[model samples]
Target: MKSTVLTRRGALKCSLAWAGAAVWTHRAPRALGFTNANARPRVAAIGTGSRWCQRATGIDGPHGSAPSFVPFGDYVAVCDVDADRLGLAVDVVQEWTGKAPDAYGDYRRVIDRNDVDVVQISTPDHWHAKIAIEAMLAGKDVYCEKPMTLTIDEGRLMCEVCRKTGRVVQIGTQQRSDESFLTALAIIRDGRIGTIKKATCAIGGGPTSPVIPQVAAPKNLDWNQWLGPAPDAGYRYLAGDNGETQSWSRCHYEFRWWYEYSGGKLTDWGAHHVDIATWAMEKGATGPTLIEPLAVKHPVPFSAGFPTDDTQYNTATEFLIKATFADGMELEIRHDGDNGILFEGTEGRLFVNRGKVAGAAVDDLANRPLPDGALRAVYKGKEPTDHFRNFFDAVVDRSEPISDVHSHHRALTTCHLAGIAARLGRTIRWSPTAEKIVDDPQAQSFVSRAPRNGFETEV
Candidate 1:
């Protein structure tokens, strides 16, 4: 594999973001094993299912999709368990790029290639950590979707591998890149809101899928590989182009509603809201010390953390989970209120969602203004740039992106703890230093699951 060198043209085009930083040297590009700077990073996308299509095609799928990787990297290959989706993605990429890219069914093959510079993992939540870790080990940078890990230990391992490999990995917690979120964090960090006492993240519940009869797996889909590390289950479908339906509680975006695939809304929207709240509170590298299930109501009965029923969506549909931090800050993560974070401070309160950032602190930003560089301070001294741009910049500069893996892991740990505590209907003690549920053996068990033999994600 030939390293791409940073071209003088590429340097000039992206020079603004690296104004004061030495982004290149006479032999730096060759030393860093990068290809010609004029050439974009070669991207191989894994998991070209519906979400991938939504990202690659800019079509709406779940949570209003965005065109991922297309704006920053060259699409060289696409991999998926579903042959149909893979073919469609190839067609879409070829149509857009005017050159058809290599397509593969197995992601392992895509990661093994030396020509690939970066890999995007938009697979189901259960598959996110494994693919990302493997990609990092293969010396490829990663742009992984949010809810970065299916379990607590997966996050720990992913962070470890990222450190070991020194790869520029960015988690897709894009709220960190949004201007409104930046404004909100700036206001909070500026102390207009006073000392933070509580943060409320009102992420909603998951939906229940209507029951459909079991059916044969679609010919284009590989049900076995799709299962991956998850327990094997029958093929299920919501609806077909011709109006046919099959039974399955989990698949596609609905995977967020199943415990086996995701941690329900606790992880789905929780990843976004909790991540923002944690950033504002400066708790990105540390998590709650105690997780108490204040009140939880689930769609199905849960014995311990496992759901007793598998017919319908089994994840918690509604609940209030409380986490107490080392600073005595109580975070209320619930299935009520608007989908956003509410910061309650000693002096004032601010509410921020995808739409707007409200309250006195945000308003005061206009009249009083944040200290110069407040926004850039939160962005790690760089100007607010596109999320993918940040990733590419870091790839070239060897700096950490705004949504680096360490902070994402901490926020994701909070979400995983909230889910575990809620499912067990018990208050669980945690040692943030140890990164484990304290004392309660049962609660500790949920920290990690036994991955199937070949699919185990280990550091």
Candidate 2:
């Protein structure tokens, strides 16, 4: 908590010491024999409604491409606010484990169990930090989805808790585990791209839907709990005959489009491509010192940083946010160009995404392939094959996972700063060492939000 430069090692040491009390609190006796390397940790799935089997079974079909957790750990519990979605997740867990897992609507109950060793937080942006912090305090490792925090302060607090508990956490920036992206990062780190001059991440835009009317929320859904720490608002349902489905624009996947819940494409895809770009630059634990909004365009009008219209979606639809690091490297995050990262250095240029890792350096890899352990080194000397597997292995080894929270918070800070800059339609200065907005009192105020009373985030 001191005002000093934050290195990964320093953060970890501070957290481990601080969380000593927390570990004692969670040390109550339980059935033993679960710590063996071969024994799978008991995992609980919080916010399972939206994530459901999309990771295990493909969204497209049974063999969907997303990562699955069934093979890595025992899926012993599922939690979600929506009864309908929770029922579905419970079914999938039963099918996968051949046994029923406990189901709960409140995540607190899930984390309180001594038998639960790990929790997968696949919740909305606002809920990520709260669940992750409590899960750690309760002595549980976490595999949280990306864009780890909704605000700058939340990111810092999450890191503090992570270090305190010394819990193994793997942020869901799975690109760090992808072969192509790993190869690209190795080439860049190996200086294949000379002195990095600039980087670009072209994350696409958000989808807009027709305005819907406020309707009664489905009886099967716990709407208040779904809203979580977000402001109190009426349920908006798509104009329809029956009330079975919520509006596609505001619920589930579409929640990313609303500033009330998320930062749209800025955090949605920026959490992916922008994170990799920052990692390649070796600035993972450090945020930009300055962020300038080149050309910002939001879905709706905004004043200060808050959306003026609550009825309609209001996150940035198209933007070109330029961030400048202390070392003078510039990162251009835009909604145009290809959906990947373009790294331009003095020697060569490389572009990479889920599809392909192309350009000169990558072409060079075919002949002069990277040495063994290159990928492993990038993944903290662990296997880079599967993100979920990496988390389970870390839980057993007590080692840091590939995508740790320190780097994630720093990278996520860039996305949050870009969103703040775009929302205010002005350039903002940032003090990376202090981790706050510089000079501008108004911009400084947006660093953290006062959560609604019951949902207040306390560390």
Instruction: Compose the digit string of candidate 2's lDDT tens values, residues 1-459.
Output: 112212322432445565555554443332123444346677898886344445332233343212377666677888888787777777777876689899999887786687887788888888899888877866788888888988989999998888767778898888888998999888887888898989999999766656656788889878898888888888876754322233454676668888878889999999999899889898986788889999987766687778787667788878999999988999999998889999999999999989998998888878998888888777777767777677766765667888899998889899999999998989999998999999999998888888876776544
TM-score of each predicted structure versus truth? 0.89, 0.90
Clashes of 2: 4
Which pairs of residues have clashing backbones in candidate 2? 15-163, 15-164, 16-163, 58-64
Tens digits of per-residue lDDT, candidate 1, 188-299, equal 8888889999999998876665654557887887888888899888866656332111334366666777888899899999999999988888898788999988888887
User: Model 1, 303: alpha-carbon shift in Å?
Assistant: 1.6
User: Candidate 1: worst 10 consecutive residues by lDDT?
Assistant: 1-10
Task: Give RMSD to native, each candidate.
Answer: 7.2, 5.7
Candidate 1 global CA lDDT score:
0.79
Best by TM-score: 2
